[model samples]
Target: MLTYSRDEIAAYLDGVVDLEPTPDAAGLLDGVAEELHALDRRPGEVVLVALANGAALLRCFFGVLLAGGVPALVPPGTPTGRIREIADRIGARTLITTGHPADPPGRQLGPVQVETLTGVLPQRHEPGHVVILTSGTSGVASGCLHRFSSLTRNAARHARSVGLRADDTILVNLPLYFSYALVAQALAGLVTGARLVIAGPPFTPAAYWTAVREHAVTSSSVTPYMVRGLVAADWRPPPSLRMLTVGGESLDPATAGAVLDRSPGLEFYLTYGLTEAGPRVSTLAAHREPRRRLGTVGRPLDGVRVALRDPGPDGVGELLVTSDTVLRRKVGVAEGRVGDCLVGPDQIATGDLFLLDDDGYLHFRGRLSDFVVTGGTKVSLASVRRIANALPNVIASATRTYQAHDGTRFDLDLYLYEADPVVAEEVRRELRRQLVRAEWPSRIRTLSLRDLGHK
Candidate 1:
């Protein structure tokens, strides 16, 4: 069942999957799959798809699966040279793209074009693998290897946990390349037979509201950055939006309160996950118990178990995750744990600090690496960034620790996006008021969004 036959896809797509108002989605997917089959696609060869979010991307996705090939997905804007480099690095023989049509030109499926490269490494049998690229801040990218069955199962669990129904319209505005948008949003919508409204990124309040109102979206998800944008613009969710989920970063209580205040009836879920753990570990229904559990990331999903390793007296330690759906491995220029083969069978050390409460809720403390010793006191850089980003004027924040010029100790440097002098001063006053002396940033710099390289 890892790969579906034409008949299976036809049966499933007839009534189960409704992507936009596009006609003959099944027919288009069939055409793509048949085209790949005729293009000499080997049963277990790897294929790369770098396309934007749309019906065409979905068609190519299932088409590769139906053609009995493993599909690796990357951002649609990835350059042709970079794609070929990735293909060579990952041994992918075929590429599905919207550019650089192959010699003798492969058939076009709507806006998608298939290109077969000649210089890929030796073909590998990977029919069960679906590669997802990680958007790490570091300059390198890694493809997370996931089994088709495990990802589907994870999506089903997430959809059920969040009460996604077949009749619901789920809005996917984030980039499809991210696992949060791919596995938890798009694939979850498909697994639950829900209609999907695909939208692109560079998320703005106007575009987000327009999509929700136009499509009558019943379900949607957002990142903390998007949440801040929505709140800053004072945009309100339409009546049709019944459930909203937040991921990608920890949602501060002030911002979460603003969202909840605007839409009292909406179900707001605060979730925590990384790409390595099949991208979803826990989700908290904050709207259900906003007064009691506003800061926690809720409990684990049905099949996932979370524990703290070597917890201190305060029950804070590095968090570890165990689940059947954890990633098999990472490939091609990955850094950190998986690159070192530190991930064990059905379990991974999350490298994040957390405190499991008596009620089983997981409260995220910070990343283990984000902490630095300053003046004989441990300081969490993530905390400083979180507090600064919580301010209304600050669009985004970043923190770095630099050794003193005198080589005495480490000093903290903070960068804020589009903050004025008044706002920066307020942030300084608030940090001193709320945080301990060691957690304060030694220097604060204000820069525009363009200067910070953010959208």
Candidate 2:
């Protein structure tokens, strides 16, 4: 288990790294932990952190853990409805945040902290619980249980894989609530004594570049959607960046090409992992980056093993993972690994099915349960999604020909038979060229789950 100490790094940052204006890492961690200790002394004996970006906010995050108290990071910008849900789920008597919301200060969740970048908050905790809430594809959530020690162990492995050095500055664009950001970026940097350059606020192209150059951000893990936005804004990241990793989902090849084109010196990676697996899992070797077209996420990392379950006796099924950094198990479940592929796995059977070529590179075939059944034929939904995305006018796509029979259930596919007048023909043409006739949809359709947000 790792505990963060910012002394030498603090000296290095002030004496060499940031040089001008930067927060003191040691003072910040100590203060935050101390404050949480004080807060624990209050009547409730429990407090929940729900802050946006602020120096104090960051401190509060670590402080809650240091104080040995449970801290639930309300993913920044979570809706008011979600805020209420989080408060209720955690049964928090006090919810902490940097500023008050526009609403009537939320009845049951009280007075926001309204962060001031003042002196450090105190350190406190004796170890109890750590919680992270994750949702289903349909958006229902279950609380994930973790100990602070589990987070530190995961961070140790993450630092080794990322080659952490005091000189490294990692651009953290993912939300702190995202386990990827916490384990792979924030905790990985803090535990290894490296600097983290936080940057989710205005999410602007200029703000991103400013952090990159100003902090000398050497590494970052970014999403493909964010990359597309930056590309649209006519921006390329600074070449000073040494490492780049993409995660959360597969990155489309077109966007990956645009990013690699800009930074000739950057070592790009496509990593795949989840919160259940202690966050750090397999990462593609930077050298294999040229192979992105196959849409391979990456190979497993140190202590992480990723193997595809045999499809029949000879092929692919859902991916099965096992590792030292893997989750011991999950809470609030019963006989549900099949009940929901997303739940009950230290060993995640990634419902996003895939196949290993003779060479061993993994290729995605949509969700396992999502295969469309047409009369008697089964079509891989992801293959159809890929075919649809390739066709012009198809922004994004999914397949639910099997689920379409029920009217109230309302699941749909990517391309519609009646979509763009020209698109239907174009998609049919592309699918025929790439897929067997058996893969063709009996009825093509457009995406309808706008409720599930993704760019």
Candidate 3:
């Protein structure tokens, strides 16, 4: 049985738990719940929420859930048209936001009605569903649906497995819309009765460390992009920080080594998951392992089963997962708009390729969909991207396979975003040193930050 309930989560955050710049979580949650209840939204109805990171956003999320209305969270800057398209496809009639221009009370966008929160009233509670959006880098984003019970269940199991405690203070730096931030960090903190320190906007390395030091934050989550930024800034974890969780992308050896060297007492956790599986499938606890594995994503989480399908000679194959936490169905894609349509089976085939080691660690090779065949040789785009991103001054990279007009042979095209001429030359040098001749990119192009997707 779980020790904490959603109703009691706000109570646990009685004091000034959230760090400076964000409102008190408990008060914000109550206010947002009051507003949601005033709307009189029906159970299971979808509500699109486009807000920036702060206490109000968190409150609105839980408030909608408590009001018996499904909440779909998107980034604050998502275009109004895109927001309407997502809401329409999800059958959502209400849109809640902070920045977008709306009428005095509300504005009509096609079938959706946009409204901003006003004064808070009395408290009321109800249960509803949650809709988490995919990164949508492929032009259209998919929405993964989950019940409130599924989130709390996995969160409780995760808290126990990870040794989360009520005394621990957690820092939430990632965007709340991402499943990793929502379930693994925010919800986990609520389940464990831990003090959540919400980091404010302009999320830079300096700001991250400042919050960690000021709040005595015990644990925090980060991505490879953030890791690179921290290392570039030469930022070191303070003594108060006990654990640093890395996900969203593979962590390179150099960055990991730098972090470990700077904070010898700090533990680094490398986790793996998709939005489909309640966003948490496996975790590699730093303390449990003797040494950090270079490219492995660790073992499966508790109650989750991972199996390989039709592995090659190297024992690499598609990873299939079966868990109660997996999404029941995902929204479908229509033309370019995503529609709320239920589609699924019992097991989810994660498009990622992996190889299980004798020690029971799962090593991530790359995505099966991103595999490129050139001159009859198969190459992993993930491997290429990892290698290129590790180079000095290279922010991010994307690779695609191109074939000649006659389709005689395939060539690899590598786009290195945010690299200057000097950095591009260095990248080439590193590529020659790290990759084989067949894996070398046929064409290399440098792009600005705007050209690449933010990880």
Residue-level lDDT for 405 in candidate 2:
29
lDDT tens readout by residue for model 3, 66-96 = 6666788877776554555565555665666
| Per-residue lDDT of 41 in model 3 | 60
Error of 1 at 427 (Å): 34
- Which one wins on lDDT? 1
Q: Global CA lDDT of candidate 2, please?
A: 0.55
Candidate 2 weakest lDDT stretch, 10 residues: 114-123
Worst 10 residues of 1 by lDDT: 405-414
TM value for model 1: 0.76
Q: Which candidate leads in TM-score?
A: 1
Q: What tens-digit string does per-residue lDDT give for candidate 1 at 230-328?
A: 888997889999999988767778888888998979988998877778878999999887556878889999999988899999999988899988878
Residue 121: error of model 3 in Å? 28
The predicted structure with the larger lDDT, 2 or 3, is 3
Instruction: Output candidate 2 Cα RMSD.
Output: 12.1
Candidate 3 yields a Cα-based lDDT of: 0.66
